[model samples]
Target: MRLRVDLLPHGQYPDVVLVIDVLRATTTAVTYLERGADALLLTATPEVALALRGGEDGSPYLLGGERGGLPIPGFDFGNSPVEATGQNFTGRTVVMNTTNGTGAAHTAAQTGKHIFLAALTNAHAAARRARATATEEIAIVCAGTDGQVGLEDVYAAGVLAEYLLAMGEFTVDDGARIALTVRRNSGNPLEALSSSGHGQHLGRLGLGEDVRFAAGLSTSTLVPALTLDGDPPEGTLRFTAG
Candidate 1:
């Protein structure tokens, strides 16, 4: 078994991929399942998310996502972890589209069979499950901000790398190493998160609690694993508890 970490660059596929967007998308998704969500379905665009489950027909689909750090016009929920609280997702599906996270997830689904959502909140569970399944290679993908590297995602990736290293022996790339270093240097993950560009953005939007929420490490025993349960072009990346 080989363990590797890297960003989800376009067209790069591995045996299995773990997607991270800790400053709230991936963290929020995991939180939903931790609460009671049956599954989450991610899409690259809002139109696709809306198309997957149309309204008024007794479907358990609820639209949720964000753009430019703001909730979509008609979304059932925004990209906030706090916003997901106290909602009833039992036997329902959350069809989501985000500025960066869902796009990375969609791209990862193009080639990988086992896709796992990773974040500081569910670090140990995610790494354990990912390391157990992947045989050839594992890519810890960070959903960067608009094609550029975001510090928060990289920091969360670093946490995943550390957990993966403790689980088994493997080779880590420079990207992984850099993230690991960040994790090592971080005295308090929340402090690191509070200073990141996205973290500050969320703070400005009155979502500072969310930034703290995303940085909560290993607080959850649940792992959100993405399974392909439908056909492509309009396929669903369904989340199941692992």
Candidate 2:
């Protein structure tokens, strides 16, 4: 097996891809699935998500996501894992659009045979799923903050890599090595997240609890995998518990 990490969402990926956005997006996704959300529809922009007001049959869809780490004005929920934990979505579908994470998922879907959303909340499960599904290669793609690399996402990638390396005989690239190094040097998930640029930014916005919630390592065993509702661009990317 071969393993590599993409610090940003660009370039071709391998057979199995794990997308990480530890600051909030991917973390919120895991929380939503764990909390009983039926399905999550990911859109690259708020406009697209908003356009999806309901299913084909007209059942209402809940809107969720953020821009600049703050709640989008018209969104029903911000990209907050903590807030998601307080709601029950047993029979509802959610449309999500964020600053980074959803776009990363769309990019990976273009190449990856299998794509899974990864975060500290489901690091172990995501790694295990990749190990079980990957036949030859695995790419860990980080959804950086505003197009720049996010340290929190890298740290989460390292956490996933640590688990993957232990489960197989995989050769890793420099990116994977860098993630591993970051994981080794970081104190803990919360500490790493709390000190990150995005984390601090969230703190100033009074969302510190979200940072703490996202720092929960292996708290959830659920792994959300991407599935297409139609085709690319016009099609929707939906995440469900895999």
Candidate 3:
């Protein structure tokens, strides 16, 4: 029950990789999936995502991503969870690229082990699942903004660490402790996020409301786990049965 938390660089390790992107890739993915999007395809590069959309055999995928906190030109949607929450993506696959979230996914995948997509939305369920896996260690990957620690992402990771702690069996690491401490220290979590690097960037683009939405804790119970092909799995919660 050893646990370690690391920023994107820890991606090379052989541990359960939990990718967190609070503002707001992972958050948006979980919202879309829970609200009925069929699947989400995480891509490292915008070119790869765009190429997949144009490929003849590709599924009808909507291109979603952001660069510098604004929607990439030619993308169908911005990387805002609020924007994604409204659609009934029942059978459509969302192809996404992001400043941090998606890149962490690819990096973590390099470990060649199981990976899970996490955010405050699915914190509890995800931690429970990780504990059940019987792995000696788990690495919670925080997708900070531009390789620098971002409050929202670290806060989300802390939420997961707290959840795992509540389970009462796993050993926590210093990184995990830092996550929990930071999350608790943000006396006014949403307010604290309004000043983060990503938050400020989104603010400049008139996306302040989205920052508030993404900062919420436990808004949904769905856990959007990554599958072998980088697409979200069929079920909303990976550990749940049909």
Candidate 4:
């Protein structure tokens, strides 16, 4: 198998793609599933998420997302793993639209045969899922902060790659190598995150606890995989535990 990591969202990915947004998005996604959320509908914008929740489709969905790393004005919950930890979402779907992660997931769904959300919280499980499902290649796509590559996401990708490399033989690209190097040079997960640009920004906003929560490695076994309900663009990327 071949492994490649995209420091930022790019062109077509391999057969299996893992999306990472360690500062928050992907971590919150895994937490939602771990807390019994039936499904997560990822939207490109907050407007779309709100529309879906208020639509007459009869599907009950809770609006959850963040803008500028803060909870949206009308959202039921922010893109926070810590907040999601105490909530029970059984039999309900969450419509999420984040500043970075949702857009990256949408891009990957356009070409990737299989897409899974990854973060420091569930690195091992995400890597195991990719190894078991990917036939030849796997791509780890990082949802950088506001279009530029975020150190936090790259570090999480390295963690995922490390687990994948341990499980089997794979040729890695330079992007993956860079991620590995970052992981090697970095301190613990929380330290790595707290030192990053985005992480520091969140800290300034009083969201440092979320970063600490996201730093936990191999803390969860749930792997959230994306499955489209319809075609691309118009279709919805529904993620569920796999």
Candidate 5:
């Protein structure tokens, strides 16, 4: 199988794109939706996120987003998986815009035949999905920060690549090989992310807990995949009761 990994959201080309933004956005989105949020409304701009929160959908939606590791002004919550998972968002919708994650989701939707959201928190499930999709080529697209590669996303991609490669004998491309090699070189994802560029910045901004949460592996069964319209059909994925 040919597996590719892209470091940025733009200029994408792939058959199946697995969007990764480990230190918070993607992690938090998956966590929130898993916790019971009706659905996640993704937006790339802060203005759009805020505006949506007050429009008709706002009543059942909670505004959540961040800018440079800090919660946006007046938002109900910032992009933190730890905090997001704690709530019982039974029938609520999360209106979210982040520095990376959501945009990556949108970008992947443009070219991927089967797009998925992957992170250290759900690597095994993602690998399972990849194996089942029966696709010969897959792309792990990272929601890089400000056009530069992000350590958290890349590290998570590396983890996923390693897991998928270990699932069975499958041909991997140089990018997949490199990602697997990096995952091995990192020793431990949490420690590696702690020293990462964006990770360090998040720590400085008092989001160390969020970083730790995002660094965890298989902590959730909430496999957030992108499909036309909204989330996938019922029973397509099963999650633990929140």
Candidate 6:
């Protein structure tokens, strides 16, 4: 198997791709699944997220996400893992539209066949799952902030690369090597994450709890696998909790 890493969806058609957004997006998603939400659907933008469901029949679906790290005006959740962990979303679906995370996932959907959401929270679970797949290639796509790379995402990418490389079957490129080095040299996960631009951005918004929640290393045993529930162009990815 071959391994590759890129920022903000470079598209490699790997059998599996881990979409990392450690600042909060994917962390919130994994929390949603672990907290008992049935499925999490990703959308490129807030408008598309709203377009997926509207009017009187929007019941059983929760509107969640953020713009620029702040809660959207009408969203029920704002990409915060701490908030997600505190709520009870049993038997519901979360429709998400985040600034960068979901957008990166949407871009990855175009090429990756089996996409998984990865964060420090579920890094080990995701890594092990990807390793077991033994796919021809595995791609680590970092959801960079505002069209540029973010330090936290790269750090999470490094954590993921460590486990994938440990599987002893894949070859790593320089991008993957850099990520691994970043994680290896990162002194403390919480400190590194808290000092990141997006982390501080969220902290200023009083979402410091979310940053702390996302910083927990390998705290979960869940791996969220994306599955298409309908046709393309209008298809929604159902985050399968396993």
Model 1: CA > 4 A from native: 230-235
Tens-place lDDT per residue, model 4, 106-182, is 99988999999998988998999999999989999999998899999999988988899999899999999999999
**Which residue window of length 10 is worst by lDDT in model 3?**
233-242
lDDT for each residue of candidate 3 in 1-242, tens digit (9 for 90 to 100): 77778855453657677778878888888877876776777776888777766755645878789998889987889888888877777777777888888877777777736677787767777777777763677788888988898887777778788777777777777888888898888766686678777888889989998888877777777776656444343221121110
Q: Provide the overall lDDT of each model, using Cα atoms, as 2-decimal numbers.
A: 0.82, 0.89, 0.75, 0.90, 0.75, 0.84
TM-score of each: 0.93, 0.95, 0.88, 0.95, 0.88, 0.94
**How many backbone clashes can be found in candidate 5?**
0
Which residue pairs collide in model 3, if any? none
Local error of candidate 4 at residue 93 (angstroms): 0.3
Positional deviation of residue 8's Cα in model 4 after best superposition, in angstroms: 0.3
Cα displacement (Å) at residue 139, model 4: 0.3
Model 5, residue 122: C-alpha shift (Å):
0.8
- Poorest stretch of ten by lDDT in candidate 6: 228-237
Give per-residue lDDT, candidate 6, residue 133: 69
* Residue-by-residue lDDT tens digits, candidate 2, 39-145: 88888778887767734555558889998988897789999998999999888888888899999999999889999999999999999999999998999999999
Off by over 4 Å in 4: 55-59, 229-235
lDDT of 1 by residue, 1-242 (tens): 66556654465666888899887889889878876887888876898887776676886788889998899987888988877876767877788788998888878888987888888899888888888888888888889888888888888888888888888788777888888888778667898889888889889999998898888889998888876555433645777777
Error of model 4, residue 89, in angstroms: 0.6
Candidate 6 accuracy as lDDT: 0.84
Off by over 4 Å in 6: 230-235
Candidate 4 — what's its lDDT? 0.90
Candidates 1 and 4, the one with greater TM-score: 4
The digit string of per-residue lDDT tens for model 5 on 131-156 reads 67846677888888877987777778
